[model samples]
Target: MTASPEQIEIALESKAWPFQEAQKLVERLKKFGNPKGYVLFETGYGPSGLPHIGTFGEVLRTTMVRHAFEFISDVPTRLIAFSDDMDGFRKVPGNLPNQDMLQQHLGLPLTQVPDPFGTHESFAHHNNDRLCKFLDSFGFDYEFKSATEAYKSGEMDVTLLCMLEHYDKIMRVILPTLGEERQKTYSPFLPICPRTGRVLQVPILERDLAAGTVTYRDEETGKLVEVPVTGGHCKAQWKADWAMRWVALGVDYEMAGKDLIESVKLSSAIARILGAQPPEGFNYELFLDENGQKISKSKGNGLSMEDWLRYGTPESLALYMFQSPRKAKKLYFDVIPKAVDDYLTSLAAFPEQEGKEKYGNPVWHIHSGTPPREELPVSFSLLLNLVSASNAHDKETLWGYISAYAPDIRAEDHPLLDKLVEYALVYYEDFVKPTKKYRAPTATEIAALEDLIRELEALPEDAAAGEFQTAVFSVGKAHHYENLRDWFRALYEILLGQQQGPRMGSFIALYGRDKTIDLIRKAIENPRV
Candidate 1:
């Protein structure tokens, strides 16, 4: 459905970061006439390693801002998923095969290096294909741009020459940031060695702006050589290349990791020197691993996109990216269940939200303002717990329990829940099962359990989860537990065999009254599992 003008106005005033970012572009359109007829949003990838969660976060976040912009203003937008394949292969990644083959190709443009996987024409092509496939799976609308093609096709010629014209000024912005030694050899351009096919970072002897060429001394042989800055013969240094990309592509908005704040500022300065406004930018916090270490694609320490999707729905992964983008969070298996539940909760709430409140909803932003109306019968967390207690080996086993809980809800009717059941089984087998530890019930806990069994016995088989909850609360209170959390903790540790679990009432209601009694009786009989 098309958003009403009133809804658009609410979106314009929305405090959500995506809307706030979209507003920046709206202001940019006002300040500088968008001569391109459309605003350009770009997310860049360096094809040195395979695509990771960080890559997904960038494109997903940029896509969110793009969607927000569409709501507020009617200006057409284009997103370019740009790859810096022309970048020199600095070092071989630790994970990929053929380390020796890759080591020999260091300093060559990534596209020029042979594919270690032997899957594509070149190393960069292999990684880029993986990236495109990953993004395609998520249905992100973007045009892929290759730095090699942009340079070789003469698309960046104008900006390449413009950088040459403002060399002294661009160097002035960059040189101060480098150490004294780096400043001595630092030129804005990195020339491709004609003989060796390596991108050489040598000091420029002279530059001819008219010819768009830089002359430099070859490190391999003590001889002067000249290469055109255009036609893929030379690529600019990191900071200069980033700035040039903005001007060359007419990028209006792009976001970077918080670690790149200084790089953004430097590149912005170079963009201004090249006579174009720098793209409106955002600095989002980086994702850390379980140990609070920053996630690196090469390090392979954090969860992969494949890993997340294997155990959780894509919407859940998207929700994880949406929340607290500027605040650091751990990206690991433990975070999956919460993210999944959060997505469901937000999605379920979208239908009832009023005007401005609707604009603030994450589901609204998640689905680009037209969130679907499907109601999830069970949360991802509850499904995980259900899988744990039943030791469900397949979706059919899970469906048996879900069918009893919501008889009208069929697997065919609720496809999302069906997928969740499959994910729950996989997650339970991989993560939950191995670490689960069941401890013996103490005398006091045994007494509480026996009382709880009696309470369940008194209640009808058709009793609601809330009714079961009240009865369980009465048992805990009657036991005179010091704190309510301790009671829940004891229940989880004893019954679920995990440190945490879904609400007992709901679990009991889904698992059935007799089965829960059996589970408790077994816990009382056996000290450990």
Candidate 2:
């Protein structure tokens, strides 16, 4: 729904990142008239490898801002998922087969190289197809723009000629930043070899502004050749290409990783030099791997979209992308459960929110102000614990417990909860089960467990979580567990076989009081370690 003027005013005062970004776009439109009659939000992709989780994040976050902008402004908006397929194939990725064949085509444009996977016409096409499929699966409303197509089809000719006209100025802006060796050869324009089809990084020996061409020495023949800066003849270096693309496409907004802050600055400067405003940008912190190292597409070390989706819902992954975007966070399997639960928390809170509070909620932006009303009675984390405790191998086993706990909630009623049951089973078997280490409780813990069993026995079978929590708290306090945390830890470590666990009251209520007592008895009688 389009936000009313009152809601727009509220959104202007709202602290949500997407709304703040949308407000900036509004100011920009007010300052410089929207010539195209629409705001363009772009997310660039380097088709050197398969699109990774970071790639999804940039587009997802950009889409969020675009949605927010739609809410506040009457102007239409477009999101372009741009691919840099005109870039040179610098190195063979480690993951693909036929590395030797890839090595043979190393210096050529990505679109000119043969597909190693034998899936598409070229390496870039293969990755680009994967990228399109990736974004399509997420149902992102976007237009795909290829760098090669943009260059070859004359879409970038105006910007190319403009850069050629300001060659000296562009050089002045770029040369000072490069090393002496790089400075000697760095040209804003990279010419495609007429013979071999490789993009050349040679120095511009001369510029013909009238002809809109740059003269360069061809490395293969050692002869100076002049090529038109327009059409498929030349492409700009990455920094310049980024700026040129912004002006050529009239991009109003784009975002990148924090590592590209310097790059963004250079691109913005180049965009200004090219006589257009650079897009409003958000520099988000990069994701880290399980080891806390920066996630690299080449390294293939962090969680892939496939990996996350294998055990978490799409909404959960979207939540991970939504929360604290500027803060660096480890993206791995361990973070999935919390992300899922956090999404649930936000989804649950959305209905109660009023005015700007609704705008502040991530789900409002996530679903474009019409977030679904589906309710999840249990969190993803709690379901995982239930899987661990019950040794559940299928959703049916979980539904038995879920039905017992919330008798009113049917599997048909809570489809998301039903899916979570399946995800929990897979997560437990794959990630949680192998890592589980249960140890025999000490005499103090045993006594505490015995007291807890007595309390449980006193309560009715249909006791609520609060009552179970009160009983557990009383038992811990009576047993003189100084920290009380140690008592809870004992419960988790001994019964659940993991360091972290769900709230005991909820887990016990869901898993059944009698079943929990049986688990504690089994733990007390056995030496699991």
Candidate 3:
């Protein structure tokens, strides 16, 4: 349901990162006079390299902001996942196949480079397919548009003509920003070399506004050529291309990394120069790698989309993307477990959280409107620990422990938990296969175990969950262990053979009070952890 503007403004103010971005978007929409029909949000992809996590992050965050606009304005909205495939292949990637073949098409646009993988028409199209495939796997709602098709089909022709009409004016805005050497040869438009079929960034010999043609010397062959600034014959330089797309598409919102602050600023200026206000934009911080280096498609430092999904669920990846846009965080494999647990934990709270709190949650935005049918009986972390302890070969064994812990849940009811069981068991074997290092328990540990057994046995079976928890805590305190964390850690190490496990009381209550007593007694009687 669409919320009133006033209601959205109040809700946005409560939890926005960097505060007021959503409000600013709302205000920008209110003040916007040129276009009054629809709200258009755009995200860009440069298919020169394989799409990475940053690509995923941009689309996910853009979707979040897009949802905010939809909730507030009720305007018709479209998200364009635009690919700059017409961008020149300046360098070959280190990770991809056929580096030497890519080197052969160095100056040509990515759309012209032969596909090294041979699955698509060209290198750029292959990456584009990869991007679309990955996003489709997550069910993103977006329209994919390519620069090659946009220009060739005359979709951006009017924008190109306007840029040509204001060429000298736009050049003045961009030239000063370039270095001394670049300033000497910069032209707003990079004409595709008609002879060589390569994109040529050359000094403009002349431009005729009446003819809508630019004459330039080829960067490669030095042969002078004249081509219409419109059509597929030419494309604007990177910064100019950005401005043209905005005016052409009437975009309302977009976002980029902080490194593009200057680029965004410059593009906004050029957009106004070409007779349209720039789209409202958010400059988010970049994701860094383990070494604090900014994660790049070239560096290949961050985990691929395949790696992330293999290790965790799409919801977890979405949660990782759902954090404050301005906060720079490391995206490594180690973050997967917490992200998975966090998604499950947040989901488990949705049915219980109050009106404002429920609406304020990221999962609400992550789902666009409705949250998942959250029936997660256990977190992925706790399940992994249980899987490790039980040496669970399949879901049946894990289900035995899980059902006892959550008696009301059925194996078929919670599909997310069923999925987690599969992921958790594999993850346990690969990442958390702990050695069984049972040791002689100290007298104090033995005494604490005895007290725990006695307390659990005396508890009424119909006791509230809090009552069960209190009984366990009381036993820990009775053994002179006031720190529940320390006491719990001892129990985990002794019983589960790990440094941690699920909440002790909850685990005991679910695994059956009687079964827990037998396990603790076995440890105490054998003097073995």
Q: Can you write out model 2's per-residue Cα lDDT over 235-352, one digit (the tens) per residue?
A: 8999999999999999999999999999999999999999999999899999999899999887788998899999999988988899999999999999999988988899999899
Which scores better on TM-score, 1 or 3?
A: 1
C-alpha RMSD by candidate, in order: 1.1, 1.1, 3.2
Model 2's alpha-carbon lDDT is 0.90
Full-model lDDT for every candidate: 0.91, 0.90, 0.82
Q: Best lDDT goes to which candidate?
A: 1
How good is model 1 by TM-score?
A: 0.98
What are the per-model numbers of colliding residue pairs?
0, 0, 2
Tell me how far the alpha carbon of residue 520 in candidate 3 is from the true structure, in angstroms, after superposition. 5.5
lDDT of 1 at 19: 87
Q: Which ten residues in a row have the lowest lDDT in candidate 1?
A: 1-10
lDDT of 3: 0.82
Taking all chains together, the TM-score of candidate 3 against the true structure is: 0.89
For model 1, residues 1-529, the per-residue Cα lDDT tens digits are 3357887777766688898998899899999999999999999999999889899989999999999888788889999999999999998889889999999999999999999999899999999999999999889999999999998999999999999999999988899999999988999899989999998888999999878899999776899998999998999899899999999999999999999999999999999999999999899999999999999888788998899999998889999999999999999999999998999999898888887777888888788878888886678888888888887898898899989988999989888888888888998899999999988889999999999999999999878999899988999999998797889899999998888888888889999989988888888988565
Q: Lowest lDDT 10-mer window, candidate 3?
A: 13-22
Q: List the residue pairs that clash in candidate 2.
A: none
